[model samples]
Target chain A: MNLVQISLATGFLLILLGLYGALTNRDILRMIVSFTIADTGVNVVLVAVGYLPGREAPILDTIPVAEAASRITDPVPQALVLTAIVIGLGVTALMLAYAYRLFRARGSLDISEFTELKW
Target chain B: MNFTTRKAIPLVLLLLLGSVFYALFAGYTPDETLNRSASYYASQTVQDTGAQNVVTAIIVTYRGLDTLGEVTVLFLTAAIVGLVLAHSKAPKGRSGSGFLPSGELLTTGTRMLVPVILLFGAYVFLNGHLTPGGGFQGGAIVASAMLLMLLSDSAERFSHRLISRIESSAGLTYVILGLLGMLFAGGFLDNRILPLGSFGSILSAGAIPLIYALIGLKVGAEFSSILTSLEATEDSQ
Candidate 1:
């Protein structure tokens, strides 16, 4: 279909793929990678939702001031996505640190191997 | 439950979820016109913030507090990573003897590229108000430069004190700028503390570029610290 619809569909598919990987992968690092994929999907979907059919970016560089309001896509979602991507990076870094610590303590990277807390 | 059944269940659930998402998205249509807030930003960004980029205006001006919180979160994560890996033993060499020297090509290439990458990062953050790139993107680029250095030489060590000083000073400057906004402008983190220069110019947008530059430096330092800690752990092992 249109570019927006295509991007939306791809985003959803990516989320599903990431979810499946995260759920099935036994390795902590693999799961973290899967979560990052999911995060990317969420960002894509957010930006896609804010897109209008053929509107330009929300920049006033080329577009005249009079026509900008009608020509620009939603800026709010773009801003939100920008913040989300950075936060996702932070979260991913934290998870990786946790993985490193777990590996250091137990010498294993498998999530299933860390069941000592489960009573 | 059987192993095969357990595996199949998640797959089936994923399929179901995907179908649900597809159905929800299939009938949706994007509006051709901007909504209320989007239109407001599009029309007023230049006049209000003097930023050619509306998204930048919305990010640094309209949602400054969120950005501050985001920077704080990144800083916290970096701190936590350092703390978590603080006690790890140093990394032995590739053969478990001592630190191994990197290849000549890697070392030479890193030396050549690191300056260029750092310059690019500075450019991106400095022109944030006039372009699509911003503090976070530039900071990530700067971190990649550190990653390149780390990869090139295993024995090379970043000055932890220097990195922390840079991080703290940038963070403090950011806070003071926010306070300045509160005292001189509309509210916290306002980009109107200084004069909004000519639109589409680099010097315009008041404190936006300044704030973004500070943010980029702080974020870069934080990421560098994280990389250093991780690399330190590798050395201790």
Candidate 2:
């Protein structure tokens, strides 16, 4: 209905799509891409949950100090989202490196092809 | 399991999860007013950190240690990626297959754009305490510039020595600044080491800008290192 609800729904949908993709994709790279989509969904949900109906961003440049307490959205979730996004990038990079090594070792990009370690 | 069944299971699960999420989201309502801590941060950010950006203030001042840890995690990930891929030999004859020589237009454009992107990244991190952008955003921008260069010129190599030096010195300075804060200010990673100058100005926010600059440089270097390592493997192919 509102922007927050729309964004929240979109975020959840993205997470579900990402989960499905990650679970079903046979390619390791595709799975990593799905995970990244999930990370983005988590970030979107976080920022959306912290959103107030018509409040401005947590910046005080435009808003006067007297009205700031009532005008700005929550800063904590935004901060957390920022941190999470960076950490997610790092994890993705690590996963990509692992994929590269796996491909180098086995000459295959498919996760199903790398079943030598499977019991 | 059959291929159709395997695909159908995840789709069904996704649909179920999506419905639950939609229900949760549809029923939820955001609070009309700021919560207690949010109110405090909104009111006190200017007085405490002298940062016009409340999000930046919370990130760099109220939760500086968390930021430090995040940077360290990024640094560690870059290092681990390098370590993990160190022994892998790139396959021969694949480089020319997957990559082509850069066009003259791209080469010239990249040469022109690299410096501008680097300067913009510096500006973003430097003005972080006053604006919406910060170290992480700026560093990522810088790394993107490096990525552009790497993509355009397959032969060009980033200097590993320079990257490591920048990373180590920035990290060292960040630690020292945190220690300085602990000794001189209220506690560890406090931003009050220097005078909290004029509010809404670049010079304000005490040590926040400095710390963020260090973080930007460190993060940029780390990302560049990761790119370079990945690029090195590509070159050997």
Candidate 3:
């Protein structure tokens, strides 16, 4: 298949791996890393969606005046990826910070020990 | 029965996910822009936003609202983190033993690379609208630089006041600029407030480059502060 298909398959595999890690790994930090892998997969797929096999960057000087729109690659996905990147950064930072706080309070990053919230 | 049920969740999830993927691929029609509009966006970007980058146009103009929402989400996260990690009293000092040295090589390398990393981060942040990198990525890189310092030095306390002031002011400025756009331009967060200079010029794209720069500053400060706060509380506990 094409690169996009390969990326999709890889993203799914990553999600599966991450799911296994999140469920089986006891450490909060490890879980977070797995989640990041999952997120990276999604981001990769999203970026891949906009990938034009042969298209050039949509700069003005590259294409003729009349054919400018037709020759350039789709930029909307890049925009989406930009937003996703920011959101992912914010969320990952928060998650890691929370994990740190948890470590401080309990002296362990093992998530199973955090039963107070569950109860 | 126990073994059967234990296996059911994954089996069911796999089937459901597989079906969904099948349907998605079957129905996955690319946008009309898959055939067109890349160039349209590119040319219009040059003509309207005065930026040569169509990605910048889509980010700063076509999808500016989404960018605003992303910023808001970050603001809310900062507030939540602050609330959760807030301590009424000063941190109690760590009674535990000193940090174990991982390796002299890592420590020295991190010390040497901090300045270069910081410079690269600034460069990326400043040239966001013109380049592949942007505020968020650059800000995070800068934060990583600080993280290395924290991991290696562990003795230098970051200035909370400097970080907080930068964070709050940057967040406030974003909203105020959005309001200014509402007052003067097409709508909220309009990049059209500033003059659209010549295409590919750094001064072009109205307020986009400035906005992204501010975002970079805010994100870098906020992330550094978060790390410092975490380290402080961890040291005390």
Residue lDDT tens for model 2, A1-119: 88998999889888988998899889999999999999999899999999999899988999999899999999999999999988898899999999988888889998888777888
Give one digit per residue, the lDDT tens place, for model 3 in A41-118. 777767767766666665555466456666766777778877787777678878987786787788999877989868
Instruction: Note the clash tally of each candidate.
Output: 9, 0, 3
Q: TM-score of model 2 relative to the true fold?
A: 0.93
> CAPRI verdict on model 3?
acceptable
- Which should have the higher TM-score, number 2 or number 3? 2
Residue lDDT tens for model 1, A1-119: 88998999889988998999999999999999999999999999999999998788887888998888988889999999988988887898889989978887899998888888867
TM-scores of chain B alone in all candidate structures, in the order given? 0.90, 0.89, 0.80
Model 2: TM-score, first chain: 0.96
Report the Cα lDDT for candidate 2: 0.87
Error of model 3, residue B166, in angstroms: 0.9
Q: DockQ of each model against the real complex?
A: 0.83, 0.84, 0.47
Native-contact recovery for every candidate? Answer: 0.89, 0.95, 0.47
DockQ for model 3 equals 0.47
Which model is ahead, 1 or 3, in terms of lDDT?
Answer: 1
If both were scored by lDDT, which would come out higher, candidate 1 or candidate 2? 2
